[model samples]
Target: MGEWVKSSCNSPVPHNAFVAGRDVDGSRIYVGRAAFQGDVLPAKVIPNNRVAYVSHNGSEHRVQYYDVLVGQEYEWVVCGDGLVPANAISPGTTSTLERLYVGRVRHNNSLTIGKVQPSRGCILIPYCHREHSFNSYEVLVKKQRPKLWKSQSY
Candidate 1:
């Protein structure tokens, strides 16, 4: 249930923030950040109603929201111990990468979705006071969708 807000050059991007994606009209959407290319980048929040399990620093945790980047032409795949580009998974697992989102567990039963920094091996879920880290977190993955087919009128 996230709302789309217009962003301008002067718009303040919170620290560790990343670009989500562009709207239909071509405006970029910024939710937060996630790990990408051995670095952190802006990512979009994918709403989920079901619980999913994740391994954080060798410990298992449950989460409901997925912070990810949507690929334009390529999808991400889970390969062995980590995620790999779709093409790189030819001899690896075909299961598309999912359940890679990160969030902080709040006492109020709410979550603060944030970014992932794989180089540091942690998920940075921001709080009003500061950013918290959960070491042994995984980077978010991007999934590409097939292009829509257009029908011609006879």
Candidate 2:
């Protein structure tokens, strides 16, 4: 019963907001459950209503607004239990390597607890760690874990 909109058109929908529908050219598109505060498409669009759910952070929402929101598969991966840089820490000036995934993120510029996956790997990390693409630093972390020392520079 919800209303749907198009992604390309200028609509009243929020910036991070998305619409489930075909482009004016008949091409299909997809958007993730979690949206940022912008007017750009988050992911590629797919044809057909095969997608049924959109999960952001930890909460899952039903893509029932076929007329307003476009349906897309949620494929975002979460990162967990890894040492991050001193600046990456949300707060505290401890020289020690602190846990980056502290179950919170800056939502609307405010502190809020994040909903994480259920798996041991990415389950403990916040949505911020999960990315459609991994950064160079993150890639290095996976490749040189054992050989690299705790404080070694990549």
Candidate 3:
């Protein structure tokens, strides 16, 4: 039998990790299958319980952790493909973030990525010609790609 934790339970993880799986260990992760296939950024796995799949819904990368008992849900931070794990979350309690993404929209803009400080409520980007720090919604909007150009075109 496996122990269970719920998002609604309103508690931080008692241990750096509160659970385990058959494939990964010592790393943070979700306990089930992903709804959509999102990018699996670099992260430390708990030996065998790492999150191998994700479903990014075009907004923020949202991931859900479910209690095996009542099937309750716990959300985790959807860290981006930056140096930090996309699962990093704010420093309040052990929360699995519901919705949030920090990466460049390569639609027509240049390649970019969102940087994050897990304990701080902020994001950073290197392309804006600014130091990596807290990013705002305005920053995200302005960062969107208005056009795409080839290397030879430059």
Candidate 1's TM-score reads: 0.31
Candidate 3, residue 131: Cα displacement in angstroms equals 2.2
lDDT of 1 by residue, 23-137 (tens): 3334344353333333332333322312222333323333333232223332222222222232321111112332233222222333333434334454544433344565533
Q: How well does candidate 2 match the true structure in TM-score terms? A: 0.20
Model 3, 127: alpha-carbon shift in Å? 1.8
Give the Cα-based TM-score of candidate 3 against the true structure.
0.19
lDDT of 1: 0.34
- Which portions of model 1 show Cα errors greater than 4 Å? 1-108, 136-139, 145-154
What is the Cα-based lDDT of residue 98 in candidate 2? 26
What lDDT score goes with residue 140 in model 2? Answer: 9
Clash tally for model 2: 9
lDDT (0-100) at residue 69 of candidate 2? 35
Candidate 3's C-alpha runs over 4 A off are 1-108, 132-154
The TM-scores, one per candidate, come to 0.31, 0.20, 0.19
What C-alpha lDDT do the candidate models reach, one value each?
Answer: 0.34, 0.27, 0.29
Ranking by TM-score: 1, 2, 3
The number of the candidate with the highest lDDT is 1
